[model samples]
Target chain A: MISYMLCLVLFSVGLYCILRKRNVIKIIIGIGIMEYAANLFFVLLGYRTHGRSPIYAIDQEIKSMVDPLTQSVVLTGIVLGLSVTLLLVAIAIRIYERYGTFDITKITKLKG
Target chain B: MEISFIAIPLASAFVVAMIANLDERIQDCIACLAALATLTLSLFAITVLSGAGSSGAIVYKVGGWVPPFGVSIVIDGLAAFMLVTVNLIALAALFYSTGYMKKYTDKWKFYALFLLLLAGINGVLVSGDVFNLYIFMEIAAIAAYALVAFGTTAEELEASFKYAVMGTVASCFIFLGIAFLYGYSSTLNMADMASVLASKGPSGALLLASVLFLMGFGLKAALAPFHAWLAYAHSSAPAPVSAMLSGVVIKVLGMYAIARIFFNVFGITPVISFMILTLAVLSMIVGSMLAFVQSDIKRMLAYSTVSQIGYVALGLGVGTPLAIFGALFHLFNHSLFKSLLFLNSGSIERVAGTRDMGKIAGILDKAPLTAYTGLVGALSICGVPPLGGFWSKFIIILACIQAGRPILALTAVVVSILTLAYYFKSYTPVLFGNVTTSKQIKAKSLFTMNAPMVALTVLVALAAFILIPVVGNVFMDGAVASLVRGISYTDVVFEALK
Candidate 1:
């Protein structure tokens, strides 16, 4: 229970970094942290004490096993997170090239 | 098969990308052909839905796996309606892109990305499970982010970055919300989860998920508070992309998902209704009131997208059968007219080589087809009589009144008038007067560009025919019935499995 709350705390910390930081790279890092938190939470949901790997054999009876479904979900989530982070970094690199700075406050090329 | 909707685009996207060394003409032709194929398949999906009759949803289980085991593709009336809207606009956008994309280098990349985006949208529409929906949504989002930055200019990059941040944040919340749902219900299948949730009744987990979804999907939809990114992103995207984004992307990603999950899965509650209503009203006022202030033609349309989405929400928030029907109708109409308008903007921009309304005055002399199409689009969006927008707004307003909400009805009328004012501000200045040529581009893409705009204009003008009882009854009844059935959606899914 406490670990679950800690995961969200990490999420909040990441959110804080995103909201407060001006550096483009830092914001990207913040997004990464938030994604990690969500993935951690999903993985945690499937955990069980003394649960074995979700393998079934014809010779042995299985009493309890960790939920493998969520592990797969988390795996997909991690891949998606990598893609998003890669895209963000690519865009960030472009921003630095165009604007010569990482400060989001300085990147005011677009406005109404 | 519904599988073809996702398969064709995915396969074509790879083909376009692999043949990068080939001629640009070939890439454009392949992309356009793929889009047409999807459009036909979408029509087939709709036809199948209608043939199955009201309350019929064809469930295509993947690999012959039974329901609640493997991912399924369910094409209910609502999914069919949404698919047709998506693929139709996708075809138009592909056609327009052939003309507009000639200026940009590596046009093949754009076609590949566009097809991938369409596949994501189609996948989202047909997916029966929540996780698959999320995956498809991310695919669409990534493609959209890349496309918005396709120009690679400073402003375009900045806009794409900003949009990515906002969109990613929204997606995270949605993911977190799905996590909560899975933890509570122990299933990812939407129908199965809904049944489990119904039997279990409401809990803290469910409530939390709902709030997270409202925030997440609301941002995706560009509803009131979360609409800031839309103006920058939509305006910065290439013209046809702007059309695609405003026309069907928001509807499919945000509005369709919300309606399906909340109305069909969670069973819309009074609280949810009230909250959505408040946001709808806010979006209406904010979107319309701010639209005319922009100098950029695409930006103005972008802001208007925010408001038009508000009108659709107004119907949805009301939660009456008539209102839902009106919402869906408005959704369909807005896709035609808004895409038409965006394509017109692209045409004007192509000819004048500028998007600022002040500089492009009286280009009607230069481009009569674009001007006239722009006028038709403007009239339709403004709810002019006999036009598509008018009928939907009229129906939504009437639905509000019948639901005993005169104030909401009045609000709809006021927003429509406000919508008219901003469009008037744009068209009168942008399309009229004898003005200079401004800055014209060297390349001429008249045939490829005007063809799609003209096609959309005709559709927009004839859109009222959708409301004719015979057609409307067949076209709209099942979609509405699906929503009105609420949580009974589970029954339909389970029944189809048999």
Candidate 2:
């Protein structure tokens, strides 16, 4: 229970960073943090107290096992997160190249 | 057979990327052929599903495993309808890109990403598993983020960064929602999950998941409050990308997901319906109000997209048979006109070298093809009589009244008028006026670009004819019937799986 609460707290903190940060790199980091937190929450959901690994052995009977589906799904999520983060970082580098600043406040060429 | 929708595009994207350097012309041909093939397959799927005595859906279990244990691809009435709309626009956009992308340095990369995006969309439309949907959504979203920044200009990079960040956040929320659903139901297959959810009833976790999905997909769709990133992202990308993004991406990823989950999986309750109604009304009013003040043509169209989407959402919110029919019809019509409008904007930008309506004039006199097509699109979007947009909007309003929501009906009428007012205000100066600037108009429009625009314009002009009873009962009714069946959708999928 406490672990789930911690995950929520971490997610909230990441959301705060994304919303409050003015630096482009910081915002990207914030997105990464939020993604990790979500992935962590998903992994935690599959946990079973005292449960063994989900892998099967031909010789033994297994009474309890942790859910491996969420683990695999979370792995995919992490990979997607990595790609998104890399893209964001690449765009940040280009933005710096073009605008000469990482501060989002300074990049105001587009507006309504 | 259904896997062909995804396989063709995935194969083409891979081939285009690997062999792009070897032969440029070959890559273009491959891309067009892939799009055409997908379009043909989608048409075939529609006919097969809609045939009399057919079961109304096709379920292909991956690896031949049964559902609730393995991922499945299910193509039903709704999926087929959306598939046709998506592939049709994709074909047009791919053809247009062949010519339009010549100005850009790397045409192959654009075709590659475009095909990947098409694959992602098709996968989303057909996937019968919740996690599979999210994975495909990510594929499409990532490709879109890269395409938005393809220009590498400061504004493009900035917009792409902002779009990528927000899109990632939305995806995380969707992922979390899927996690909650999986935890609650212990199943990933949508039909099985729906059955589990129905038996157990709605719990706090289920409600929380619903909220998370609302936030996530709502942002993707750019619905009202979550719509800030749309104008920038849509306007900054090259026009073909913009057309795809505006025409098909949001509808497929956002609205289709919303309708599929809320109606099929969760089974829309009165409270959920009310929430959808409120969001729809807010988006309708706010999106149009914001659009009325924009000077940039593409930005205006972006906001207009937000407003038009509100109408579709309203149809879903009403949740009546007629309303869903109107919604699905509008969804189809919007894709036609919106893609046409974006393509027109692209051609105008190519010729005039600017997107600002205030700086350019006399396009009708100079480029009659682009001007007329754009006018058809603009008028169709404004819900003018004898056009596609009019019949859909009229049906939605009528549905609102029939559903005992006269006030909402009145609001729809008012929003329709506001839609016309703003489109006329912004498009008139560019389409017909004195040649204000000395920007020389290119005498000839590229045939490739002009061809797609003309094709879409013809479709737009004839779109209203779909309302003819024979066609409406055949094409639109099937989609409407599926959604109106609501939670019974699980039974349909299970039956098809058998």
Candidate 3:
């Protein structure tokens, strides 16, 4: 339960970084941190102390097996995370080329 | 057979990419054919749905394994309606692009990405698995980002970047919500998850998941609070692409997904319904009021899309049979007229060489066809009498009244008047008044551009003609039945799987 609350805190911190940070790269990193917190919380949902893998062998009893679905879900989620990160990096590079800066504060020609 | 709706477009996108080295003409032709094929298949999906009466759901298991173990595509009424709306606009947009996209350099890449986006939308609509929907949504999102940046101008690139950042954040929330749902249900198949949710009842965790999804999909839909990105993104894209984005992409990725998840998967409670209604009213009022201040035609249309979607949301929020019908019908009507209006704006932009409504005066004398279609589209969208928008708005208002929400109904009426005022403010300047600049560039896209606009105009007009008891059943009532049935979805899925 403490860990769940910690995950929420991590998410809030990431949000703060995004809201307060002026650098585009920092904002991207904040997004990444938030995603990691969500992924960690998802994995924690299926965790139990001393729980083994949720797999069955012909010779062994399958009692107290840990939920494995979150593992697969998180794996896919990590791939999604990678793509978003790459996109953000690409956007950051483009911003640098176009405006000659990484500061989002200066990237303000698109008003109204 | 149902899977073919997605497979056809997916295969065509790859084919377009592989043969992109061929001539640009061939690439454009292939894109148009692919879009036309998708439209035909979507119509077929609608036919299949109408014929397959009361039969739970049609599951097309990819590798022939039963769901809960294998990924499947669920073809039902909601899927059919969404497929029709997306593919119809896709067809028209591709046709319009045949001429307009000549301004851009790499024609093949544009077509390939467009088809890929179509595939993503179709996949999102039909997939039974929650994770698969997210993947398909990302595919569409990435393709849209690329398309928005296709012009490579400073403004286009900046808008695309902003959109990408915000869209990625929305996807993160969606993924997290899906993870929570999976954790709660232990299954990724939406129907299977619904069964588990039905058994367990709504928990704090599930409610949290719902809220996350609402926030995520609301961003995607450009609902009131999360709509800042839309005005920029839609305005930055080329006109036809903007049309497709405003007309279909947001609905499929945002509104359709929200409706499917909340109504079918989790079931709508009074609290959730009330929350949706509040968002709807906020979006309608704010989006319209903001639109009234925009001088750029496309930007104004983008805000109007936000406002019209508010009507769909309001209808869905009512959670009654008539209300759902009105919402879905308004959704259908909005897609048709809005896409047509955007295409008209694109045509005007093509001729006038600018998107500012003030500069493009008295175009009616020079471009009669586009002017006619623009007027029809504008009036229809603003809920003028004997047009498509009126019936749906009338039904939505009636549903609000029936549901004992007179204030919501009154708000709908005020927004309708506001919608009319803004649209006319755009229309009268562009279509009537004095012939401003006589730039004699031969406009050569009558078949590819005007034909689709005219066809959609007819469909919008037909909506009014058939709003009576006879034709209303298949068009509106069927959609309402699909939504109002709600979590009876689990039973339908189990029965269909058997």
TM-scores (chain A) of the candidates: 0.97, 0.96, 0.95
What is the per-residue lDDT of model 2 for residues A8-91, given as tens digits with 9 covering 90 to 100? 999998999999999999998899889989999999999999888978889989888899998999999989999898988899
The ten-residue window of minimal lDDT in model 1 chain B covers B436-445
Better of 1 and 3 by TM-score: 1
* Candidate 2 A-chain TM-score: 0.96
Most DockQ-accurate candidate = 1
Q: How well does candidate 1 match the true structure in TM-score terms? A: 0.98
Candidate scoring better on DockQ of 1 and 2: 1
Q: For model 1, how does the per-residue alpha-carbon lDDT over B309-424 read when each residue is reduced to its tens digit?
A: 99889899999999999999999999999999998888888777788887777767778888899999999999999998999999999999999999999999999999999888
What would the per-residue lDDT of candidate 3 be over residues B436-469, giving only the tens digit for each residue?
A: 4464434644677787888888888887754686
Model 2 error, position B9 (Å): 0.8
Worst 10 residues of 2 chain B by lDDT: B436-445
CAPRI band of model 1? high
Candidate 2 lDDT score at position B262: 97
Runs in model 3 lying further than 4 Å from the true structure? B52-56, B437-446, B465-471
Misplaced by over 4 Å in model 2 are: none
Assess every candidate by TM-score: 0.98, 0.99, 0.96
Model 3, residue B477: displacement in angstroms?
3.7
Interface RMSD of each: 0.5, 0.7, 1.6
